[model samples]
Structure formats: structure tokens, C-alpha cells
Target: MRNKPPSLTESQYFLLAALLDGPLHGYGIIKATEQATDGRLRLAVGTLYGALDRLERARLVEADHEEIVDGRARRYYRLTNDGAAALQIEARRLQQAANVVIGRTRTAEA
Candidate 1:
């Protein structure tokens, strides 16, 4: 198998998860993350954009399109294939870690 990307931070993971369904603009991602986390992951505009910049550099996400809305420019982003794989790998890793803490074994799966 190919090498997997490094694990994502909670913030990065949340941002990636927000893009699982097609593409979303920066505001949409911020709102979606907060809603998904029950208002726990509220992101300021600066934080959101900063994470976006890093994720873009890591090739985990890319701008899919842009729009001019009410005299403002909005850029929408989509998760790249590599990003999806990283998220899946991280999810499985976390699940295994959780199972260990819960004293659940592999055979628990039915």
C-alpha cells in the first residue's frame, strides 16, 4: 500500500468532514462544523481561512469554484482523493484506539 498522510488535528478533521458532501464555501464550512459539533467547533473567519490555507497546501482540499455574492467573493472547496483517504485512515485508527480503551476486541463485530 502507499504511504498514508499524517493524522489530522481535530480542527483539520472537522474541516475535512465538512466537505464530505460535495463542495462548500468558507462560511458554509464554518457553519456546518459548528452544527455538526453541536456548536462546540465554532470557527472565526480568520481561523477558518487559516486552516483552509494549510489544507490547500497539504493537498487535502482545493478550491472547486468561486462566486461573486453581493459584491463579495466566495470560494468553495472540495476534498481531494488523498484527503478522503486520510480521513478514513484516521477514523479507523481512532476507532481502534477507542475499542482498546473500552476493552472491546475485534470479535465484537458481528
Candidate 2:
């Protein structure tokens, strides 16, 4: 059976994070993710597109429009309301978990 789908994958988190500022084309999303992660998460073209497809189907993202970039067609995407909500929830969860670790480390040092 297929697993539950509420949980966001790392790729999804990064993608959604990139869109939090505004819409972006595939390459823009790739660059944003790389820059945000300080070059730690370079996504291959196929992987980025595949993740975009999944996010689109999940209603977490939507294609804004298509445009030509140096004779190649590029599609822009933006996060939906659901996507923003999911991203916010995931970020809060991560922040809370991080606080626990930080508190433990500080206590041990004290």
C-alpha cells in the first residue's frame, strides 16, 4: 500500500521554501534551492521536474505560466495556499525540534 502523503520530503521543503518569496521557473527554483542551502542541494533537471510534477499534483504548487527562454520553453510555478501552509507547518516543526537540541546543549554546557 502507498504510504501517507502529509509528510513533506526534503526536496519538497526546499522547493516550497524557494517559492515562498515568489514564483520561479525551474532553473530559478534550482538556483534558489542551491543558494538557500549554500550549494548543498543541487538538483538534477529530471529530479527537479519530477518533484515539481508531484507537487503540482498534490495541489501544493501550481504552474504560473510558460515563457520562452532563449528559444526554450520554461514554466513558472508558485506555491498554493496549501503549499504555504504546509511549508509553515514544517518550518515550525523543525524550529521546535531545533530548540530542544539547543536547550539540551546549553544545559549540558552550563
State the displacement of the C-alpha of residue 61, model 2, in Å, after optimal TM-score superposition.
Answer: 0.3
Q: Which ranges in model 1 have alpha carbons more than 4 Å from their true place?
A: 104-110
lDDT of each: 0.90, 0.90
lDDT of 1 by residue, 22-69 (tens): 899998999999999999989999989999999898899999999999
Model 2 C-alpha lDDT per residue in residues 2-102, reported as the tens digit of each score: 32336788888999999999999998999999999999999899999999999888888999999998999989999998888888888988899999999
TM-score of each: 0.88, 0.92
**Runs in model 2 with CA error above 4 Å?**
1-5
Clashes of each: 0, 0
Clashing pairs in 2: none
